[model samples]
Target: MPMGCPFLSLRFSLFLSLSFATSSSPFSFFKLQSPSSSIPKATSSDLLSLLASPSHSSSVNPSVADELKSCFKFLVPFTPINTRSSSDFKSPSSRRSLLKSLRDEQNELIWWPPEPVLELARLAFDSGGDPDSIHRALDPTVMPVPDVEGSKEDKCELTRTPYGRRFISQELNSYLEYLFKLIVERGPDVGLKVSLNRYDLFHGHLFIATETGRLGILFHAKEYPLYDKQVFPYYLGYCQKDSNVTYDDSINLRNILWLAPLPSNSTQGWIAPGVLLVLDAHPGGIVYRDLIPEYVNVVRTIYEDDLGNVVVDVNYLNVGDSQPDYQIFIC
Candidate 1:
């Protein structure tokens, strides 16, 4: 495992104050409460139980229950039934039957929140252990929309329109932008002050998958202050690949998310994990046939940077057919 850099040590924290208003949408049932308020925070076990079996809890709001059911239905295939000690599965056949039933229950037309956003909701649940936070994280209205046209200089100059743009909806785009901002905002504190570039070129699709098993948008270089000349050189070096692969031929900006080293448990060396969240839902997948090598090459370069490189593991999680794909690259 890679360790944290002493020069880039910083703690990332997300502070959310949730307040809800009544709306017809299923997600509107989540009411926001301040962290400082008297309401007790839900434990991890409590949240897992609610997500695993929302029907059993009478206190769960009807609308929220409906949403949880949708999420549960979507997550069933990817969740490992055997590892769940709390589940009362009698045999392998019963587990398979249940999974099949869950898959059959899925409605093709119903709109569920994007997989990356849902994964972020899961992460929020794990960190804060609050059900409301999960809903708040999935709420599109609360997410910040990226100002693509406003910040041109800060963006990387792309040779062409991103391949994944067509598949991403406006709502999903906002959610991806929100995630980029959150990561940058919560990134390690180095000597420099990190900020969002707010450029569309900084955002694209990497042909990657999210936790829900669907492709997602890539938010590259969200933390690096692109305007700074000293920092810009490193950004260019990071993107530099083989001479045969031109800027147009390579996955230049697609893989670079945050440049700063994040806090990690390992004490060996600096560990900067690059996360790829695929939100695109096109059945045919987005990567151009010729550019597939570019994507693989970038991942290869990150892992095998030095001659005596340490072994780094990349974890992937997939769920439903339409769910987004999620991958974590520790470099």
Candidate 2:
């Protein structure tokens, strides 16, 4: 647990109204909201009960449930551009070279006015209740595909279409609920002390530090960055087609991202506004969980809705499983 953890004070009836700071480094804690504030509060007990259960239950009060749902509104559904096994290249070198070429091409499309950029521009408008402005900000042009040698048209096809074709609505909701429950289970004191890894942040992967000197949860660190490009590539396109994929187990992509509090360090650079939390799974390679064994006693939560929809939620990476596929909670 963190030193003098504020979560302990939460039990004393504290109400936190969290808002990201609008600065180059936006990691500071904001002012607390009074009990009578319009923002709903998630009591310490309410959080603990959600955490204690393996799945989602309506046992908690409606206010806490509403707040939990609101946290996920800004999350953008996503998929990876390429995986190691998605091609028929016999050698690792061949696959690596091709993946790099594709990533470089996709990087050029992240500018404002594209599909994702256009969608992102609407978040503020939607929240502010200005529906008329959402479409006005979009650039409807179909982006031009990159023309590179070797794959040429194929590379262009991969670059322009890199996100997931279909959003996993049920799974995404379950993942967020499970994440919130984990924090509550850790208690307020423990949550305050969690740290973010600088190395992971630089590569856009998220690493959470739970205990005093150990690593917590690691999301989207499965694939090593391209040997030439030190920074891990972010996919602006969609998943590869199964017909073009020749690698074994290439289709087993479980995309999920953790949207949580990040610790700010002087060297980590600017924090982008309205960031989305999308978790990417490990490439077709051996999976490694936590480096430290002490942090590997995994606990999965199952949330059941009134409609009898069951969600057995597990974190992205399987930290302790010898065969990660079998241990994965989601099918």
Candidate 3:
């Protein structure tokens, strides 16, 4: 188990007020509420249990339970961890101040897709194996191609599109395949298998972002500049190393996928979910051990009541590892 590594099993306890007003919608009570002393503090275990069996929980009000069930129905396809032993898990190290600053700065530039694209994606998922729906969702008009420049020396011949450059139709096809393998067809034992040769498609800047501050799937590409300019330099300075190094020098931002929550909301703060694929981070070295826990801490802190009380299960497969390892964080 990855828990043996110590770093992989990081836990966090975040206390927030749960006093919320009841919404008109049957399951809209998950909305964030004002501070109240009457309600009991909800723990990670409490939320996880509710997700496992929403109808049976008596600890929370029926409205809250219903809302949580509705919000997390998308998680039905994921494998549930029946037994969690936190004895081996340690609290993530203190990087809160640094993360807060990053959140505040990057929150300004967070992006989302148009409503039509999101609707198409939803249609595709709902329609299951319908090729037309899938094609509509993956279409360049619905899914904007990344604005990247390509070179003749590149391994594959690049085709220029109005939005960006890609290798014929391979990029879109690969992205569709990746979505099915990583999310749609995911099962108890399935983990995203990313071949190094097709790293661009498998480990690209594609991510799932939520309006309620949740940044799902992968890291936002807009934050790449933040890391390259500020975060990376600070890390080098902390180690008393040369400060001239860039983020790309240490790890390829393109190859790293971050699944967490946004520090805050975007301009249009309505509750909507969208997929963002920004091809900016150039491929580089492997992600470091310390960085993963840093991201987990960010997720634990930034995730508010947008989706109600929920647990985030993060699984990663590093090069040469026998199998993918995982850790669970409550958000």
Candidate 4:
């Protein structure tokens, strides 16, 4: 391996070699081993239980820490798009290349006629009656399906973004929930492993728990701007509570554009929104913002009825293309 040769000169070779440890996917709800076990439909209590468990509070995993460091590197503006020596893996070129590709592929959705849920809710409020009557006046072809299925229906309907498949649901919580499944139950079972890698703006730093009540992994160094793009940065921290991912100290991602908050496109039948954005801070800790004069974007929230019906809850017409500051809570 020469100094800059495929292995010696570039770090990508070393990264490929780091998988010495391997892990990690999919199943139906009814077939699982839970209270319902049939559809994998987790109730509030189940979620609460997981959140209450201490296993989630483990010390940060070194790989995840490195990956996160890489993400912060991306927040820096036009840092040299060099290779990364991520964790045991060497070379950062792959991450830099991967991020450039991802950025190129991102696409924003269009603002449109207000979605049905919000429209219906408003109509009912104005008419002093349920908007159910609107059903008779419209065509059914455009109606939302009670249940959307895909290759991995049990996992979740995929999340979409201007940058391609970025999240599961439109709500922040929904996307986090999907991630929770992967990290907690799924990531550990097989050879799946997560690091704070190139998937910037998607997660904050977290430790993978090795046991019920002990620290398993640790990684991080207040190392900011961990990527070639260097557009966003976040301070990774361990959770104090079990299974709970709450950050006692508020993390502001507005310092860098890469970490800006994403719009929640729930009405599009997406389960969550904005779970992918990570943010950074300026030199003096001031959020450097741009007065973007663009407009005519929209966001919609959706609600479903128990009998298996879909409805819009609220919708907003965002006046510009810029994103807001938000904390990413990847379970």
Candidate 5:
């Protein structure tokens, strides 16, 4: 529900492109093509069907009741933002309506949107201030930012679009440096500037990502046909409170896989309206049983639904011998 909102999709068409080039017109470049014309993938109706089924009644233990919370890290309770509370903005009615979306829209690009840290970083960069001074001016929690402050102006130039740049004048070796020069040919403001390699998924135990919120531009292929007809796949991952781990993908919970679902941790899986999770499987993955107590219990009853949605129930959180002992992220 704030101003100048940022952060927000992907689909099965991933095999085609990695760089996000928005097609100006309705062209095949952006529009997703179906995987197989016949026997299409499952939609939200499947989950609703499962939930609505008599077999889904309160059981002694849910098929997924024993999962752990350590994986998610927080309880991101998203509340809808409506008309009355949005009258605060001074912009035209259109922009004001956007401002009013502060609550319900669930802007996922805003990891701790209240941090106001990036905006401060932007202001500092634009002001041509020292990185040291800028670093000192920030929240100690997310400090030591990109570390561009004290670097030489000649060494670190502000791209025309504004985010600071580590200019590489040399093109002696591979053209990668040249490519870097070309990629940001515009500026970081055009989109996220974090390193795609820094995505850190293949290297970590748990893959976690969150924002105070982000926009639900489209439904996650896995969680398709969202909760409502107008529903989209907007979710703010719960941050990790116990460990120092951060998520591997974009913090913005917009749909990453545009068409069919991303591969699941199980042999095959489907994620639906009720908390669908893609857990990394490995000793070093984020929700390893040894690392967290509740995770141990969760590993016990975890099963993929007929459609593959993970159905973790509350009892999983209350397990005795392996109840999660640490507080992860604050949803």
Candidate 6:
């Protein structure tokens, strides 16, 4: 969570207001509305109901609605922070005790707006093209990456290995760049700014600055050798393993990307919790599988279940395969 420059922070916020003016104030601008305005104030329960209901009947684009439903079903229970409460703690003393026990678990429970998902989905569907198309338009060779010594010519490309190649192929890299720009272009409409924070080749982390938040996107290549039916748990186990063979000295396992929201103070100086999205590129296309439960499980095990994480994934182009469409795994 490196600190971003002040300019980056300002730009993100500024762009957000411009891009998302229609929906940015669901939380912040509530206080400014005139009392006599015909618009009714929205409650957390109301919002929850809206989110839980399928958008099949709505006038929204079918693709956008479908994408929204896929991504937001997991977030139905979350209430706005200003009006949030827990039924478990009945008494004031009990609430204080619970808070003390968890050392600010309440604070970690963050509230997020749902409008962005719809907006993002709109953009995705509007493109009229899929990730597969983008993937096919580029060269197949895995692009070479420079070595740690700042010499690309002298050292053999570290990512040239079969697994590495799959992880950072030229097409995927190009798609990544395109996606970043597309997301940023919506900043002004969404009332936030978007910028690149940094790309740490050493850690394989791509950081982005969005509105008042920063996101760290990790490139993960699923190892066929390590594949398991219970994929999420297995990946976490692998992330926890030490670098050495078991039953011997210390062995540190390679880090796998865990699905979670941006940290409180994530990349750059962003303080807001950004959205957590997963894109899985298989031979068929890029699929957006449901990872909400896995993300919550991982975050809760490592920390308290404060604010839950928001999960979003892109819909893949149907490649005429028998593989079923990705669905929301309600838990």
Give me the candidate number with maximum TM-score.
1
Please give, for residues 51-144, the per-residue lDDT of candidate 4 as tens digits: 2212221233433333233333221122111112113112212222233443232311011111332233233333333334333323333322
Sequence-dependent TM-score of model 6: 0.22
lDDT of 6: 0.24
Residue 37's lDDT within candidate 2 is 44
Candidate 3: Cα lDDT at 40: 43
TM-score, candidate number 2: 0.20
Residue 43 in model 2: shift from native, Å? 22
C-alpha positional error of residue 238 in candidate 5 after TM-score superposition, expressed in Å: 33
Runs in model 2 lying further than 4 Å from the true structure? 1-135, 140-143, 153-156, 159-331
Candidate 1: 10-residue stretch with minimal lDDT: 9-18
* Candidate 5 per-residue lDDT over residues 1-331, each given as its tens digit: 0001122111212212222323431212222222433323322222222222133223213322222222322112322222233232222122312334533222222222212322332333333333333334322331111212211221321111112111121221122222222222211232322221111110111111111010111111111111111221122111111112233232222111101111112222111111222222223232232222221121111122212222111000011223322111100
Candidate 6 lDDT, 1-331, residue by residue in tens: 1111222331233233334434432222221222353333332122122222122124334443444334231211222211122223122223233445331442232222123322222222233323332233234444222232222332212221212222224333343343334333432232223232111112233322222122233322111112122322122221222211121100001111222222222121112222322222111110111221222211111111111222212111111234422111100
Task: Point out where model 5 deviates above 4 Å.
Answer: 1-66, 74-103, 107-195, 198-331
> Deviation in angstroms for 224 in model 2?
14
- Quote model 4's TM-score: 0.17
Backbone clashes under 3 angstroms, per model? 17, 15, 5, 65, 37, 27
TM-score, per-candidate, Cα-based = 0.25, 0.20, 0.23, 0.17, 0.18, 0.22
Model 4: per-residue Cα lDDT at residue 12: 32
Taken over the whole model, the C-alpha lDDT of each candidate is: 0.25, 0.23, 0.25, 0.21, 0.21, 0.24
In model 4, which regions exceed 4 Å deviation? 1-105, 109-278, 288-331
